[model samples]
Target: MDAAARQAVNLNVLRRHDPAISAIVDTSSHVVVYNFDSATETWKKVGIEGTMFLFRKESLNRYGIFVMNRLSTDNHNEELNSEMEIQVMGDYVIYRTLDDKVVGLWIYEASDRARIAKELEKWVVAARQMGAQCLQQSWIQFDVFSRHLAVFIICALAEDLLQSVDTDRVPSSVSATCMLARFRPDPPVSAHWFLKV
Candidate 1:
């Protein structure tokens, strides 16, 4: 598909200076990106075949992402309430928006996937310590997460997926690359290299 003529967004573009983008759903079957027009200040969306990218600046401390884990064209409400409910069941990590959109994550495609889950859980716990613990008191407010921490979560689960998984299983380099370059605490690596592989 001609992704550009349609102005389809790439998560890796990492242009953080755009208008009010609320969320992105980079999934396997479809891509849903949400952004607000700076001039018109209206919500807009761009969808491609199987992944999505979105960008947004804060609005009234009310900016929250409203994406789940699948291909969807249903993110049409104009509310910034991004309260998410998170849960860890066994080794699975579940993330749900209060409106009931949900997705779960665990380690796969890595050797010793259980260890990856364990390590990821540690990071989740750390985020809880640093943010507002919410819902069942077991998870925390994801909106409170810094972009740095959010990038870590994406990379931690899919670190070795450089060549093994399809684009559907891989989080876009967009989510980690420029997103991290903006405020990453560690030295930046060439994410393009990974994506090219």
Candidate 2:
């Protein structure tokens, strides 16, 4: 599809001023959203294949990420409500939003990407038992705007993924990357690079 046709609503490319970051998943899918990066420019062919989870951002906030071993279900909705900003990092949950809206929360918490893989394995097994559609690696990637980091949450279950995993000890496969060039755009210019994932 054409580049312009691929973009979603909430994302205004004209608003993105960062040179290192490119696009975010303005649309939604069953698994995750996809994002593009320019700095050290990284590109993935997945976009053309119709990937569900992808996003792109201009910056990241490290302090917003929280790695917990287990998320408490006693007040599940309350936590997702109170935390405001959040993302599911493997078996853990990370917070990124400043207000209480269930939309546009750009956050990722796992800093070790490898351990996150292990945790995903566990999550998939459990999710399958519940009759949820699960995705394999290279299928889902989590884009945390606040942290500028993306976690490839492969093999996502077709259920409410945000509510499936534990919030604590979010494994260690997740990593954070900050793209600061996305904040200035008075004069529109071509981005140095564009990512497919």
The candidate that achieves the highest lDDT relative to the unseen native structure: 1
lDDT of 2 by residue, 104-161 (tens): 2122333433333333334334434422322322123222221222221221221234
Best by TM-score: 1
Model 1: how far residue 190 lies from native, Å: 54
**Which tens-of-lDDT digit does each residue in 100-158 have in candidate 1?**
54444342333323443343345445445434433323222223334546667666555
Over the full model, what C-alpha lDDT does candidate 1 score relative to the true structure? Answer: 0.39
Give the least accurate 10-residue stretch of model 2, judged by summed lDDT. 61-70
